[model samples]
Target: MPTLTIRNLDDRLKQRLRLRAAQHGWSMEQEARVILAQVLETPAQNDGAAWLQRVRQRFQGVAGDDWQPSDRREGTERELPHFDP
Candidate 1:
């Protein structure tokens, strides 16, 4: 196991951490370890593909089995106006 030290942490923040640790029935060090593990183990959602995947996963099967796509196509192209170039 390795030892980690945080230098010059705010007194108020440390006090709050201590209170939280006591509330959760853990020591300050143990609570810090738990917090670090939780925050560090989670995957990042910053990538566009990752975000899209999460969105798809959340709404999976939300449309039900009866959903169908409409057959739509682009409209006819319009002629460009004559310009004196």
Candidate 2:
């Protein structure tokens, strides 16, 4: 395995990474490796599709054919409030 060295990273970002690694019970190096692998392996379309699938799955029951969008036309003609000095 080859060792990687990163340069000029922000101090805050490093702290955030350390905190996140601790939250996930990982060493900073292991967490970085996992993040790198995930980012490299997943294509953007696949990531988007996966996210859409998860959302659809979550609302599958409420998203039935009976659903209807409410009208936005009612507010279109409303007058703006006059601010008098």
Candidate 3:
């Protein structure tokens, strides 16, 4: 594994990390690794539009406020499903 050196980390932040490490029965380094792993496992959702686009792509033909009947030529639409955070 590659080595990582954190320079000029805040004293209070370091203290908090130490306490968290102790509470989890892990070394500060191990705690940091676990935190990083958990965070990176999820895709970032900072962009609402982009997140909505992904949902549409994943559920294509099943969602969107612009949905229409395959046989209909008129501009009919339906409400997209509500998603909770």
Q: What is the alpha-carbon lDDT for the whole of candidate 1? A: 0.90
Task: Give the alpha carbon lDDT tens digit for every residue of 1-85 in model 2.
Answer: 9999999989999999999999999899999999999988877755788889888989887846887777878678877899999
Please estimate how well model 2 matches the true structure, expressed as its whole-model Cα lDDT: 0.89
Candidate 1 has its poorest 10 consecutive residues by lDDT at 68-77
lDDT per residue as tens, model 3, 50-81: 88988888988764577665767556777799
lDDT of each: 0.90, 0.89, 0.88
> Candidate 3 — worst ten consecutive residues by lDDT sum?
67-76
| lDDT score for residue 57 of model 2 | 87
- Residues 21-50, model 1: lDDT tens digits: 999999999999999999888887687989
Summed over model 2, clashes come to: 0
Stretches > 4 Å off in candidate 1: 55-85
For model 3, the local distance difference test gives: 0.88
